[model samples]
Target chain A: MSQLHLTDEILMAFADGELEEPTAAAVAKAMAEDPTVAKRIMDFQQSRRLTRSAFSMALMPDVPPELQAAVLAQVASYEADGDSKAGSDIKPPQDAWIRRKRPFMQMALAASLAAIALALGYFVGWQAEPGTGGLIAQLESPLVHHELNSSASGKDVELPFGRMRVISTYRLANGSLCREFQLRSSTEAAEAVACRNSHWNATFALASPISDAGYTPSGGGDPMAAYLQSIGAGQPLVDEAEAKALAEAGR
Target chain B: MPAGIGQELVALLPRLRRFALVLCRSQPLADDLVQGACERALANAGSWTPGTKFDAWMFRILRNYWIDHLRRMRTEGMMEDISMQTQLVGDAGEGPILSRLVLSEVQRAIDSLPQEQREVLVLVCAEDLSYREAAEILDVPIGTVMSRLARARRRLMEMTAAA
Candidate 1:
């Protein structure tokens, strides 16, 4: 059969291990006979691997505390209601609980960020002294270094000034790994990008009050997003890739 | 909820969370979806027949909840929240950065797929559901699942190759 004759559906089935035995055997025979067919099958297999790996993290993270609690609570409530009973009466007060909890969670996040920022400022100021390249040098302080090296994208790393969320990561044109993070306190938010060289360099940093709620990590409205775009950052490095780059940089 | 049912639901959380993450592309939202689905599953636990696949039933509930949430968001004009776009990008624990990067690239490629195709791909490729199971979860014909998976995989390859 011509290469074009092998439909993507058949190939996809083969990749997914969904092909029936005889058909799968036929495809295996054809693959052995045809290098192009073999290559296509290999590519399909690779895509399947990639697809599976991308979300594998979901399985690794400890179930979020809230979720775990919710599950246990449900089980507990059901048990309390006497195992056989079922209905709306036994429903966990999820809506009311969420309503009460969301604001507290938001405030806790805000306060934590604030405390982190304050401490970071004090330490950075104490270390930078005068004429040490100001904030750029401050951005390279040991705390920042530690946070950058240790935290993965989408995680909030506690810093002296506030909580730093490593929002996105990318490789620069020159092949250095760059991380874009948003540091936020109760009152302020700053978006900064740092690239690894011999050490982490604050390639760009911008801070403002929490007014830019409209700006997203990837949306064009955010200055950091624009900056990354201008620098031709093709795509952010995955968490593992970012960690490896940091290690290589001796961070 | 029956003790057996509760245990089964708890056991299925990880897989459900994985499916939710791929569908919503945001961790917070994914967790919310899972929580909601679990609640619904428990409340309506009697609807599930004995010996049926619990995972498929939960998946259907999760997908339905997601679709409903999307519709509500669209109605409320709240879909533009940038924070909603953030996705937790790596395993919480340790892994190779190169593999993670490749995974992230692959994820972005998948994220760019149309919703229909993306859901099918997630069910078959990531969740490892059989075509029949996926079709049932999606409430579509088996042929539909196969076609969507094919298109999704093709698009993913093209996008990643271009990158």
Candidate 2:
């Protein structure tokens, strides 16, 4: 090995163990003979050590709950789409995945609904009265109108019952448009999925308050999700496709 | 498009967020970056080679998003100030106070580096990715990775030592 001074890149690669054996041996021999070479190598090593120390995983904030819920919801939505498409014959290797994922999806969906409540500037105490079939009847026109025209980032509508907004729109396998929506009253909230036919029909409804606490969906999973599965719901439409869907429906 | 890619993505969120936070220096933007990258990764999961490093693939997706965002911001005259103070902090419930203090100082040093240098430093030093892996993620040559890593470390050492 010649006694030429090592470039910082060479020293760093050597320090990082990125150099080939022969080049690394030359650098090792140089380091033994030259104190400055040894010091330079030590600097690169210390810098990496210090950086790794500073940004230790322990320094990280807990992943925010909303972000976690959002990711879980995404995974669940994809899983639901796969389930609807794959059918009975294509069994997933992990049977436990189905068992473990449902409650989580429902919980995440519930949490997101509650988060929407917060985002919509509604307080948590107000609970919507259950079994208000007449309210659904009265809500039919505005809900259908909004479903036809509004984007998934829905506009807030003041209803006789409460403020309601469409959450998302999806197409079921049988070729019908379905929308998931939420209604918040002064003290309570509910989320429902309505599919279009001759008229929009509420296929699934959960009358729980739009709060994370004290609300677990019936059957240890979301009936809305199960209904979507039973009906073979596709993924939610993107904004552009959604606009096109609305335009076609309007025509 | 591995069977467990979704779960793998979930596992990587913390480190992904850390890298984003280090690069963008904003918590909200970091979250957005990570979320956008994950969505892109899932939507185009087929494009990823089955046996390659999943983390590197994700980092590239995230870095591309960051680049696109910066381009959009610049075109729209909404360019962010890169010198924004980072929100990194030790958990109040854990770690020694000295580590917390050192963390802030080191974070400041990292924030002071150019974006290019900071990214290479984080990938190589903090994330423990090899030079080649970092180069692949950055879409730069291996030599560029080496030079950038050297300059970034030297600057970081100078700044921290001075502090």
Candidate 3:
């Protein structure tokens, strides 16, 4: 007999409980008889079990029941506020970090231009291949002193020219790692932190601008804000060594 | 629209929440993401057209958001790994809760899958979406979904089997 090759859609239909009773029964019977088919079913079941387990916890976050009510209430309020005004356009604080990030990028761009120019001058003697400069740049990055340690705090900071701060210290479900941080006072201003793992992730919180200065961190009662204040100017946020330390620290 | 639609949207939360968690495989982040999705859905409530499955629409939004999140993640220097099969079973869970062990292994195993395959698994197994519906949400042909899913299932089989 030609071997029966089960398609994923069939397995999926079976997995999702989408198969009609008779068909499902047949699949069950077949799975029981064929070890390979049985294994496939188990794998699908395992995948399902995993997804359910992970997401199930996320759903019931013990978000203070009152907080849940509050979030919903806030939603209602936002809908009501939609027509009354321009709507809360508070451009999340991370936008400030994003804005602050602009200058260094321009610097990096300028550096690239300079590097290219130097490369061209040095290679002028030969009709080199088109891809030469890239290879040179790659080799040269290691020669420079600016190093990023993937093993540091599992956290690293990136500021255009100014300073930033750490946000949360938590290991991600994935082994990659994560850290949260914010930018302190700046006129083009705001708050928020960026997270990253040893791999160089920089995830910024949703855009939330800095709240008014009058509201003390104690008054605001937001952990994110109080933490930013506690860090002081948030300057010298993190260096390469510290970054590596955070990475290795596993958070 | 009347409040009925709003209530309907709220009703879908449990299922949607389940889908979000499965995709991200992290409870805390999953909750955050679901909250973000809810906020976005409500904020753009006016844009929802009648006669469409809100779940489907929300799934699309969630899928797009996830893609964006992944793109943003790429800039952070994510590494790719291809581990040996023998070690797969060696890492199986050892915890108080039997379910937790199974669950954690499942989560890690799912994570090992390529992005394409993982989405298929999420759609078919986690979200209970039909192949055709998954096709629409993923913006791909039904066959493509099937192909990716087949490949994903194969990979999962490889990763989960005892060495």
Candidate 4:
């Protein structure tokens, strides 16, 4: 059995600060004498520094106060609704996400909403639907039966784009329910809103993908872009109650 | 199971976000991932056992969930856009000393790396997880971890260099 030297594993350990005193000491000793090895180590550190800096810029995104409020309400509901293991299944809120371009735009959207809210004299809280508006909403959506047929549980919900893992759920003004779901692939996640009207019209009200899990969604690849585009593109934004509720909500 | 795991999860948000940033490069998704893991941990708190580091346990769950998420993404694909790293580089903003260098060239290089190597680098350098802990979190043998780390670092260096 040959001893481990600058093996990829050892380098990884070194990078992670995992090497024990003796082992790390050995790697350190090797790196000192080996300029190539030392340079490699430096490169790793640089990646860390740069990556962290870029991502850190997006920690607090611009989440709409209404959506935030909605999430808060739904979160409360989630807490009160169950006790399988309190706090064991909690999800982070929209505001807490690490953001990049999404924060700025989300903030812009939020600002616009706030302006509208103030104009209308309605104190719309920020945040979106947590759980398909309500169970009723989810079941009624085009994707509802599809979702349930696939597996619409607390953990994972099947959607058109893919299987959406339920991060949280909330209710909306138009009798539409919504919840944040992460698509199975990539860093993209969005809220799907549906109303409990026996024919729940669940739609990807909006979607955004993070850099990973820390940064906010960008505008281009954002599913929200599609939904928003479809709206302006003459595609009716809502099928039934969601449209009405969105109207009332000034969305 | 231990008490106050929820509080612990709340505290872990920052670090977890950082790790997720490296893995997926998106904040919302990262938060979603954290929430998913938190919810899972809370639901399965009984399995955590007393005396275990809640942080590690949560991380293990998080890493597991993250892997599953990745697998799903690979099969179904996702909305495509300029990778976040590219968007950052385009900024060229006159920010702090560090932020300037965080632009696209290096990030692209990192992105180009294989998933295994990228995961190791993020877990180790970015997240600062020790080898043993990373191994546990990744559900890989220690040797496999070490090798992955080495390969990731080497590849990172090459990618960062003039291409």
Candidate 5:
């Protein structure tokens, strides 16, 4: 191959291992014949390394618990809905005897009844049945309303259905107060961003449930994160600032 | 929901998150993308052929979702401020000044590339996808992938050298 024929694209392809064997062999010959060619190839390799190292932290951070739970929950729900090939083979973990004997099961039953009651009471204005309030109502329960009204940013409230935590409070460019909160229940979790007008309008909401495993409360897995980025939510209000905002808004 | 699919999906989370980070360039947004992709993957699990490459399918879904998101943001006039917040500079006492400056400059150079070039570069160089695989994921021609990757590298080299 002529010295001038070793183009930058060819060298990059050779460095990236995208070239065919014969072409690679020809490139190797060109590099051997020319130190500048070899150095350019080396620079490409080093740049790739630097690019990888620059974002290496992405791989290092732990997968947020909410995300893990979301995946597991979806899988479990799929399986439990009798869609899996192994659904018939696998038995429920609790047998009749265990369920009849365990006091924990009784407590669970009671808690479930209480949850049903709370859902009914909270959605009474919109719907009589539990879980029938549609997506907006499912997110805007009495507890969530109270939490949004009473809790300052960065505070958590333990409600009957789940734990609600106010992540951040900010004002939109239109001068309306917006709050991002996370609601985590035993079976599912949701993150929502609501902007206050006459009432809180859910600008965005996403839910990911836990699988058979019980609930665990953690932070930072929000499906609306990208939307929030688009909207340019600069920084969350700190404690004092959140308090001041809430007070000034007469909340 | 297939017998072993759950475990496989779980195993792929870390890599998926990394790829999402490469696409979105923000940790929280990356996680959001992963979760959204997982939801769609679960809902459409039956459509996935049994013997197909699952990772490629998932990556395609994520890329499509991101594209749709970008389109929506653009329509709403919300695209200009979507830059990822990276803390490139640390406290003066934290690290050597020369090394920190180099790192910051390298990051800025990478960030300055156009989104198309950045995506291809991340897929090919960072995620170790072959040119063809990156093309498949990005739904672009193989030659397009190669050209974009080359342009990204050339731009990075020029910017960093100038810095």
Candidate 6:
């Protein structure tokens, strides 16, 4: 038989185990004969693996109790009706519940964004003080510098305002050592990013409420979140890698 | 209708939500979609075949529901919300920002694909559905499924390589 001309679709199907047996045998023969064919098959397999792995953590939120209750309520309603078909035309609780919930969600989102803006404006007043060139000279305080360089992710250090905690440390794609920190005063809290060069400097800041247990993005349009994305920050460092990154920063 | 479907749906909740997230790209919307799909599934329980693939059947219903939702949104002039909400990718106080960064990067890449390719990619690669099963769910020919899968993988590979 003439050498089987394998298109990408055939190779993909062969990798996916979707090809017929004889065709699969032919592809196997092609793979064995041609190194390139094997690599193509491997590429297809790798793509499948990458997709599977990416979705392994596919931003799944915990199932809300209301949703569970709604589902069970639906089932219960179905069962309660002697004829399930009678319930078939009824509107789902989720339909009404979500309709009622949407406006509230949008309002909450708008309120949070406004609060973040107000906070950013308040925080910007500090930058206007005479000689500081738009960046907060936070590291000029040796104690703050020491804490930022050596503090573990969850450690709390007392700041003059209230309290400061390093949320995470990671390297930007350009190999800059950056730390995400939350500064909580008695009344207000904000998450800020600082990266070190000759010294540490605050890069971006967002006003976040002190009420939340963990830092959350102030909705999608916030600047600090965009900064994180633009800088290509990878996953926060694990303990060992964090130490190594800190050490490399000459701590 | 089946004896264990309630429990099965409970078990499948996370995966269904994940699939909805991949399609809808918004947490609140995905939750609503999954709940609605579950409600529909229960209300139409008698139509489900007893011994067939339960998850695939659920997936088909969810996918059909999503298409209908898109149509409804278009009719209501609400199509802008989908694009605006696409940027909202985190699990809302669930995971650390650390992992969310990496995951969101992967999500951005996946999000860049055309919707047709995205649906096929997620169905086959993430859900682990067979091509034939996906074809049946998508109401497309098997060849069309393979072609879409091929294009999606190739685009993803090129993206990974460039990144």
Fnat for model 6 comes to 0.44
Q: What's the TM-score of every candidate structure?
A: 0.52, 0.56, 0.41, 0.44, 0.52, 0.58
lDDT by residue (tens digit), candidate 4, A1-251: 24645755555445434456677677766665665555444344444444443344343233334434443444444456565443433232222111112224333333333223222222221112123232223334456444422333356654654566644333444434443344443434445433334443444344323332253323222333333333332222234443443344432
Q: What is candidate 3's lDDT per residue for A1-251, written digit by digit as tens?
A: 33445776676556445455566667766765555554455345444444544334332323325425644764676556554232332221111112111323223322222223333321110111223333223222321112232323333345443234443444333433334443333422222333344344322222112323321111111223323333332433345545554546544
Task: State the displacement of the C-alpha of residue A162, model 3, in Å, after optimal TM-score superposition.
Answer: 72
What is every candidate's C-alpha DockQ against the true complex, given to 2 decimals? 0.15, 0.15, 0.08, 0.09, 0.15, 0.22
Candidate 1 residue spans exceeding 4 A from truth: A1-5, A57-59, A82-251, B74-84, B90-103
In terms of docking quality, model 5 is incorrect
lDDT of each: 0.63, 0.65, 0.46, 0.48, 0.62, 0.67
Question: Which prediction has the highest DockQ against the true structure?
Answer: 6
Q: Write the per-residue lDDT of candidate 1 for residues A1-251, one digit (tens) a residue.
A: 43445777786676456667677667767655665555465455445555766655433455677897898788667656664534542222112112111323223322222223333331111111113233333466778777777788898777666677888778877887788876766655556777877777776665543422332122112234445666678777786787786677663
Clash totals for all candidate models: 14, 6, 24, 61, 0, 0
Give per-model CA RMSD. 18.9, 25.5, 24.7, 24.4, 26.6, 16.9
The CAPRI category of model 1 is incorrect
Chain A TM-scores, per candidate, are 0.41, 0.42, 0.25, 0.31, 0.43, 0.44
- What is candidate 1's TM-score against the reference? 0.52
True contacts kept of 5: 0.38
- What order do you get sorting by TM-score, best first? 6, 2, 1, 5, 4, 3
Residue by residue across B15-37, what tens digits does model 4's lDDT show?
A: 66556545555545665676666
lDDT of 1 by residue, B37-141 (tens): 887777777666555566777888888888889889989987756335635464343234323443355667887787789888877666666777787778788
lDDT of the structure predicted as candidate 3: 0.46
